[model samples]
Target: MRIPRGLLAFGLLATLSATAFSSEPQWVEVRSPNFSVVTDAGEKRGRDVALHFEQMRSVFGTLMTKANVNLSVPLQIVAFRNTKEMRQFAPLWKGKPTEVAGLFQGGQDRSFIMLDMSIDNPWSVVFHEYAHQLMNGNLEVRTDPWFEEGFAEYFASIEVDNKEARIGKIPDVTYQVLQQSGMMRVADLFRVQQYSKTYNESGDHRNTFYAESSLVVHYLYDNLLLPKLAVYFDLYLNQKKAVEQATQQAFGMSPEQFDKVLRNYLSSGRFKYYPIPTPPAVVPAQFTVTAMPLADAKAVLADIHLHSPDYQEKALAELQEVLLMQPGNAAALRGMGYLYLQRQDLDHAAEYFRQASEHDSKDPRVHYYNALLLNRGSDIAGTDRMAAMKKECEAAIALDPNLADAYALLGFAQVSSREPEKGLEAMKKAVELSPRNEGYQFNLANSYMMNRNMDEAAKIFRELARSNNPEIAARANSELAQAEGYQLAAEGAPEAGSQLAGPSDAQSARASNQGVSVEENGPAPAPVPSSAPVHFVKGKVLAVDCSASPKAVLSILAAGRTRKMYVENSARVIVIGADRFSCDWKNVGVAVNYRDRSDGGGDVVSVELQ
Candidate 1:
C-alpha cells in the first residue's frame, strides 16, 4: 500500500540526523552553477546554481519594488543539474539512488523549499515555491494545499519583463492545443474546489485539480477579485475554516454557484479540445509535395486555417515523398517522425525515426526520436525493447550531452530497463542540461513517484507547484498536493534575466503572456519593435488568434487598428480603479496567439488569426 498522507518523509530525515549531525548544518553543495561546497558532487554546478539564484533574487527585488507588495517570507530556490540526482538527497528507497528536489521539507516551519529546474522559464517554478515561502515563512500560518498550492500555480504563470511584470491570465497555448482537440469546458477546467481533495481519500485526480485551480484563479484574478479572495484567505488561515465557508464569504455565493458561472464563461467560447470530435466536418489541414526531383521534394506547409485531426497530414505526406526522393534524406525522415509523434501515431513515428537514425548515425534527434518511438509502442516490442531504447537514448546523449531532451528520454529508458538508479541519475542530468524546460521535470517527478520514492517525488512536485508560470505551477501543485508530504521542502530559483531586443520586446512578451509580473523602479528602455513577433507574457493582455470568434474584438496591448496581435484589449487597470495601480499580476491567466505566417517568417502573433 502507498504511504499514508500527513507523515512519511520526516522519519527518514530524522533518522539521518540521529546518525550524522554532530555539528551545525552548513548547506551541502549540490550540482549547481552558483556556489560550491567542499563535498562530493560539489564541483562546478554548485556555483552555477548559485549564480542563477542570485540573478533571480535581484530580479525579484526589482519586481517587488515595482509591484508595491511586501512579502513576509525569504524565498530560496535551488537549481538542480537533473531530476534523478535531485531525488538522491531524499532517503533512497531500497536500492534507489536519489531524492526529490524542489520539495519543502525538513526546514523549520517549512522554511526550506527545493525545486528542479529544466525550462526556459525558471521564474514560474521559483514563484510557486516563493508563494509557499510567503505563506509559511512570512505569514506564520498553517497553509492549506487548497490555498497555497492554488496560489503558487496561479502566480508562477505571471511573467515580467522590461521592468514590468504581467498579471493573471490563462495560457493561449492551453486554449490552442485543446481548442480543436478533446478539451474540457472552462467551467470544469477553472473551478477551484476541484483541488479540495487532491489527496483526499483514495488518491486524487491530480491533473484535473491543477487545471481546475488554474482556471478558478484565472476567473477570480481576471475579474479582479483577489482582494475579496484575500478576506477568505484570512478567515481560512485564522480559524482553519473550510473552503465552503471561504467561498461563501469571498464570492457571496455557494461554491456550486460560482462553479456554474465559471463553467458558463468557459463553455461560451465554443472552442475546445477533447473526446476526438467526429472527423472535422470540413477538409482537415494537409501538407502536400506537389513537385519532386531525384533528391528533393517540393514541400509547402500551410497553417491549419482551422485546427483538424489531420492538421499535419499534408506535411506528413510531403515528408514521405522527400524520403522517397532521397531515401537518405535525414531531415525529411526526422520531420515525418516528429509529425507522427505529435499525432501520437507511435507506430508510424517509430518507422520514420528508424529510417532517420539509419540515415544520420550521429544526429541526436534521430536517436532521441527513435527511442521515443520505441517507447511509444504498445506491444511486446515495446516491453522487450528497453535495452535497445536505452542504447538509442544514450547514443543521442553521447552525440549531444546538452540535449536535455535526450537526458529526459534516457532517464525513462533507464528506469524502464530496471537500472532505476542509473535511470534516475540520467533524469538529473536531463534537468541540469535543460534547466528551463517543463517536460523533463514532469517526467523526472513521475519517475520518482512511480518508484515509490515519495521524498523525491514530493520535491519536484513542489517546484512545479510554485512556478512563476501558471501552467507549470498549476500542473505541479495538483500533482504535489496528491503526493504525500510534498509540502515539506522547496528549492529556490532566480530569474534568468533578459537580453534587450527592441521596443516591441515588452509587447512581444505581452503577446505570448508567459510568466509572472513583479514591481521595480528602473527605467527599462521602451521596447522598440523588431522582427520579433509578440508573445503573451502571462500577466498582460496581448495578441488574439485570428481563429477566435470573428468579432471586432481588438487584440490587447498599447497598439492596434489593423487587428494586430499586440493590440490592447484594455489598459492595465487595477481593481478598485485607483491611479498608479499596483496591479499584482501574480496570476497569469492564459497564453494564446498566432504569428504572421510570413517572415521573421512565422513568428506567432495571432490569438485568433484575423
Candidate 2:
C-alpha cells in the first residue's frame, strides 16, 4: 500500500478538535542548512534525526561530487512515531497502514519526505527515496531502468557514523535474494524499462530485479567502471544517443562481454564493503525549535497545501480552524496573504503579509511574501516601492541564504531599477540553487538577454520551449521568437505583471507589438525613431491632455523631475495587467521611451503600462 504524493490529500476533520489529539503527541522541527526534520519524537530525538540527515547529506554530497552530478536543493522530512500518528496528520491513509518505511514526494519547485520513524532502519528508506528525487530531474527522459534503480539500490545500503561511511554493502534482503537466485544476465537487465510490471509491482521477478540490480552496481563500482558508467549514464540521460550505443561508446565493450565480466566479478568475491575516509566536520543549517501545539502544526500543513490549487479549499478550511485555535498565527497569516495575492487583492495581501512579517521578523518566508507584494506595488508607486522591495528581498536572503526564490525576486528588482548586470548575478545564483525550477530558469534567461548575452539567452529559451508544460512552452517559444527577431502571435491578453521580466528595452520591443494597438485587428504605426539616443524611464502618470483627441501631451515624473512629452496618437499603448488598453490615461503607471527632440522637449516613442 503506497500513498502517492500526488494523491495524498488532507483536510480538517470536521468533527475532530485540536484537543482530541492534544494528549497524543506534540511536534517539533529541527533544521539544518539543507534539510528540515519535523517529528514528535522529542527534542533530543529530533536533533539526532537532523544530525543524521546532515551526515547523510555530507556522504551523498561527496559521492555526487565524485560522479560530477549536482543535486543541490534543500530537503524537508516529516517523521511520525507510528502509523496511527501518521494517519492523523496525513488524513489520506484513513487509518490504514501505509506498509512502507518512507515516501518521497517531489515537485517542480521542491521535494519532501514522509516516514514512520518506528520502522526498522528508516534511514535506508530515506537514502533510497532521496536518490530517486535527485536522479529524477537530471537523468534525461530516456534514462535506462537498470542504471536508475541499480544506482538507487546501491546507495540504499549506506551507513554513516561520526563522519565515517561504510559504502557498497548489500541490504539483508538483497543479500538473501542474491544468495538464493542465479545471476541475471546484464543484457536482459539493461533492456528492462521502468514501466515493466516486474519492476513496478510485487512478484518473484521484482524481488530478483532488486537483487540483480544491486549486484550489478556493486560489480561496476568494484571494477572501477564508475567513471565510464557515469559518462554513459549522463549521455543516456541527455538523450545524446540510444542507451545501447552510449554504452558501447563509453565502455567499448559488447553487452555479452560486459555480462561475462559482471558475473565473474560477482563470483570472485572482489566486490566487498568499503569504508570512506573520514569527512570534514559539517556545519549544519541552524534552526530554532519551538514546541508547536498540534493545531499549530496543522496550520503549517495548511500552508504547505496552499501551494497546490486543488488543495486551496481544504487549506482554507484548515486555516479557519487554525486561526480559531491560535489567533495571529504567523503561518496562517502568511497563508492568507498568499490567498489574497492569488485573488489580486493587493491591498489585503499587503496587510496580511505586513502582519505576518511583524509577527515573525526573522522568518524568511514572511519577508519573501512581503517582497512579492512590494514588487507588485512598485509598478504604481515608482522608485521608492522598488527600494522597499529590494530591502525585503535582502532581508529574506540574509535570513535564509538558500531561499532561491528570494534571490530571483531580488534579481527582478535590480533589473527593473536599471542595474542589469547586478540583476544577472542574483538570477544566476537563484538558478544555481534550484536548477530544476523553471521559474528561476526563466528569470535567469531573461536576465541574460537583458545583459545582452543573446547566445546564452537563446540556449535557455530553446530548452524552455521544449518543456512538458504547455503554458511554459508557449511562453518560451514566444520569447525565443522575439530573441530570433520575429514575434509570436498573441494568445489573448496576459494578466498584467504576470511575466517574470518587466519593462526593459527588450520587453518594450515586445510590448510595442504584443498588446497596445489603435484598432484590435491590425498593427499600429511604429513610434517615430529618435535621431538622438533614447532613455528608458518609469513613472506614474501626472496628467494627460486628451482634448486634442488624436494627439495627447503628458507630464510624468522621470529622473526625479516632471518631464512633459508629446504623445502621438499612433504611439503604442499597453496596460500591464489588463493586457489591452482603452487609450484612456486614468490611473496609468508606465515605462516609456523618452526621446529628446530638436525643439528642446522630449517625445514619447512607446508607452507601456507596468
Candidate 3:
C-alpha cells in the first residue's frame, strides 16, 4: 500500500535526555548538500538524519541510471523521535492523529518523507516509502503496480552502514508469510493495484500479495533478469504500451508461462544476494551546527504560519520579535518576501527573496519563492527574461519537484519562449498536481493554445469562465474568446537576434556559475593556458561538493586511491545530449577532464556523463 496507516509510531534515536522534559519544543534544522531536514528530535537526531539521507543519495545514484532520477530536487525528511515529539511541534503533516509509521509525499516542487522514530525499525519504513516517492517523482512514466510495490519492498530489506550496503540479506517478515502461504498466480498479481480490494484485504491474503510481488521482483531483477526487466520497463513506460503486450515482447513469456517459471524458481532454494564490499562513504556537502534559539524557532513558526490567512497577523508579530533577535534569519526574510508578494510589491519581494536565497542556499522554499519573484518581476537587460525565469523555476523544481507553482511558472515561460509541446506537458502536470489552483489551470490553457490545440484550450477556458471567482472567470472568458478566433494577437516568426544572453549578477553568483567574488588567499596564482596539457580520469564519483562559494571539489575513486580534483566555479558540466541542468557530479560513473596541478591535485575543467 502507498501508506501503511495502521502501523503506528516511527523509530527515533533517544539521544537527547533533557529536551524531552522542556516546557516548549526546541527545534533543530539540518541542511545537507541534498536535503533540508527539520526535527524536534534534537540536533543529534537532525545530523543523524542528514547523514543517513546523504548516504542514500550516494547509493541512489547507483540504484538507477542518473537519467531516471531528479537529483536536482533536494530531498526533505522530517523524522520526529516519536508521536509525542511530533505533537509538540506541528510539522507540515501532523502524524499524531494517525498510527502510520511514516508517509512519503511527492509534489511538483518538492518531495518529503515523514517518519515516526518511535518504531523499532523506522529505517525500514523510511526506505520502503522513500523508494516509492523516488520512483514516482523521478521516473518518466508511471510503473506497473506489481513492479512498483515489489521494487519498494525489495529495497526495504536493505541494510546499510557507513561503508557498505548489504542488499537482499536483511530479514523481512513478508518472506515468512510467503513461505507459509505459498505462491500466487502471476496474472492475479499483475492485476492487483494499491487500491485494489485484494491488496487491502484484511487478512494474510494481503500479506501474501506483498510477499509474492517482492519475490517475483527479486527473481526477475536480482536473479540476473535486469536486462529483460529494463527492456520491459522501457516498452511499458517510455513507449506507453499495454502491460501484457510489453511483457510478452520484452520477456518473451506469457503470464501463465512466467507464473510456472516463478513457481518452479521459488521451489528451488536459490535466491539472489548482493553485498557491496566498498560502498561510497556518506559525506555531508556542507556540515554546520543546526541548533536554534527560541526566538529563531518562533521565526520558523512565523514563516510556516504566514501561509495561513487566519494566522498572518500572529505570524507577523512573531517575525517582528524574531528579526529583533536575528536580523539575518532566512525564514524571517522569506516571510517578508511572501508578505510583499501578497501585497504585490514585486520589487521588494524580489529583493527579500534574493536575500533569503543568499542566506540559505540549501533551502528549497527560498529558491521556490525567489523563482516566483523573478517570474513576476520586470525583465533585466542582459538576461533572457524567459530563460532566466525558466532556470529559476527549474532550480526550484529541482529542489522541490512537487512544488506546483514552480512547474506552473516554468510551463508559462516555456510557452512564452515557444516550446509549446514541452510547455503543454509541464502545464498539464501542474494542473494535475493542483486542480483547484486557478493560475495553474489558466497557464495550462495558455499552453494548449500555444501548442495550437484550440479545442482543448477552449474546453478549459469554458470550464474556468464559470468559476465564481471573478478574476479567474474574467481571464478565462478573455482566453476563451482568443481561443475561438477572436484574433487577440497575431503570430510572427522570430527575426535573427543574439543568442548568447548574459547572466545577471545574481545568476552568476549562484552555484551553477562562477560569479562569486573570490577572496585573495595569497599571491595571484598563475593562470593555466588554454593549450595546457589535458588529462582524463574515468571512475566512479565518491564525493562532490559544490557548496563552496567560489570552487567545487570532486573526489573520484580512480586507479585504486581517491583523487581530489578542484574545479573552478565556472567549469562546465555536461551530460552528453541531456540538459546540462540535469547533470549532477555526485552521481557515479562520470568522466572528468582536468590538468594536473603542481601541488599533485587535479584542476578539473569539465565533468561529463557520456
Candidate 4:
C-alpha cells in the first residue's frame, strides 16, 4: 500500500531529545543513473539499494515495452541499519510503531521509501510499493482494485541477481493465507473497490481477497489472457456491461466458471515463473558512492519529517540544529524555507529561500521554492510580480530541466501576465514531464481555455470529472459545465452566449491567475457588453400567443406581475434544458434573459427550463 504523507503521525520523536541524535550513524548516498539511496548501513548496502531499484525500473520498462520508465515525482530511499532505527519512521498503531520491514510514503513533490536493512527480505514490501509507483507513472487509465493490488503483489516477488531476473513467482504465504482463510467468491472479489470494507479493513476477508486476486492474475498471466483485460475493462466500465457478461465476452468464462478455473489451478500444484536476462546497463559497480555530511544527512531526514504531517515541530527543531552546526548548508536552508512556506509564513520562507540561493544558486529546488513563494504572495493585477515569478521559474528550469512544477507555475504566471501562447507552451512542457500528474493536466486544460480552445479544454475536463480524487473531480465538473456553456455560446447562439458569458468570463480570467491571486483577490468582475443590457427573470410561463406563424409572444408571471416577452422567431430562439422552444407552451417554469422594450414588454434572448 502507498502511504500518503502526513496521514500517519508517528510520535516517536515528539520532543527534541538528545537521544534521537546522540548516536547518529555514518550516512552514505549512493547515486545511480535513475535513483538515489541514502543509508546509514554503509556504502555497500546503499549501493545495493540503488541497484535493486534500477533493476526493478528496468524490468518495468521491459514489461511495458518502453525504453524508459519514469517516476512522475522524485523518490528518495532511506535505509536504516536495523529495525530499531526503522521503527522511528513506521506508522503508529495502538500507540506503538507497527512492525514492518519497509514502507513507501508518497507526496506531491517527492516520495520516500524507508527500509530496515536488518530484515532478511525487506525487498518485497518496498518492491510492492515501487510497483504501484510504476503503474501510476505508466498507466493512463484507472483500473480495478483487484488488478492493481494483485499486479503489485505479483511484481513484488521479483528476484534480480547480477545475471538474470525472475518474475511471476507466487509467494508461499499467499497460498497459506488463502488455504487457512478460504477464498471469496469470484464475483464478490471482482466487485471490490478501493473504498470497499473488504479492501480497507484488514481481516480474513481482506487477506483472502488479496490472495484470490493474486491467484487470478497469475492464472491470467500463465494463460496469456492478460492482453484481453483491456476488452474486459472497456466492456465493464465504458460499455456498462455486468461484470459476468464482460468477463464472459473477454475471457470466455462466466464468474462461476472463472471461480472454478481459479480453484482448479490453485489445487493443481503447478506454478510457473519467468526468468529474463538482466539488462547490462544496470551495473552496480558503475554507481558512485559519496559520504554525506552529518548535518546534510540529518537535513534530509528533517525534510522527510517536514513532508510527514504532525512532525513539523520536530522537523523545525532538526533543521535549526543542522543550521546551528552549519549555517551555510543549502539543503538545510531549503528545508527551513519549505517548512515556513508550509506554515504560510511567506516572509520567513522568502528570507530562508534567499539565503539558500545565496549559498547555492545552482539548487533547482531552492529556486523553485522561491518562485513558489513569490507566486503565493503575488498580486493578481501586478504584472511585475508575475514576471518575477516567471523569471524564478525559468531559472529553476535552467538548473533542472525536468522540474515539472516550475514549468506549471511559470505557465500560470505567463497566462496571468497576458502571454497566453507562452503559458500554453509552458503548461504543455509540464504535462510532458509528468504525464500522470493530474494537477499539471488541470493547469494544462486551463491554459488551453485561456487560449480560447474551449473544445480541447472541455475534452480534458470531461475526462478529469471521472477522476478518483474528489477535489479534482469537483473542480473538473464545475469547469466542464462552464466549458459546455461556452461551447454552446461559441456556436452562434447569441441568447445562450449572453446568458452564460457572465460567470464564465470572470472564471476564465481567474483561471489564468491560478490559486494564489484568486484566493487573495477573489474573482475578477464579469464583463458586460456595451450594447443593449441583458435582464433576467424567472417565473412560470402563463401563456404563449402565436398568431404569427414564426413569431410568438409569451405572458410570464414574474416579480408578482404579468409581463409579455416577444420572440421574433420561436423556432430559432435559444432554448436551454430542452431540445427546442415550444410555441404553445404554458404553465412551465422558466428563466428568461431578454432586452427591455419601449412598450414595457421584453424581447426574449434565451429561455431556460427550470
Best model per TM-score: 4
In model 4, which range of ten residues has the least summed lDDT? Answer: 513-522
TM-score of each: 0.31, 0.65, 0.53, 0.76
What do the candidate models score in CA lDDT, each in turn?
Answer: 0.46, 0.65, 0.63, 0.78
Ranking by TM-score: 4, 2, 3, 1
Tell me the spans in candidate 2 whose CA falls farther than 4 Å from its real position.
1-24, 29-35, 66-74, 91-99, 106-111, 132-149, 161-164, 172-216, 233-239, 263-270, 276-298, 301-315, 339-348, 375-380, 461-610
Q: Which stretches of candidate 3 lie over 4 Å from their true place?
A: 1-31, 40-45, 67-72, 87-96, 105-108, 180-182, 199-205, 233-249, 264-270, 277-281, 284-286, 295-329, 332-367, 370-408, 417-610
lDDT of 1 by residue, 393-493 (tens): 88877876656667776776565445666777888776654444555677677667545565777677776665545766765654554343221111111
Expressed as tens digits, the lDDT of each residue in 94-174 for candidate 2 is: 434346667665543345677777766667776787777566434333256677777788887888764567887766677
Model 3 per-residue lDDT tens digits across residues 385-461 = 55677777888777667666777767755654556688789888776555556666777876675566767887888
Candidate 4 lDDT over residue span 142-229, tens digit each: 7899999998888888887667779887788888988888888888888898889999997888888888888888888888898899
Cα-lDDT of candidate 1: 0.46
Residue 242 shift from truth in candidate 3, angstroms: 7.4
Better of 2 and 3 by lDDT: 2
Query: Candidate 3, after superposition: displacement of residue 304 in Å?
Result: 7.8
What's model 3's TM-score? 0.53
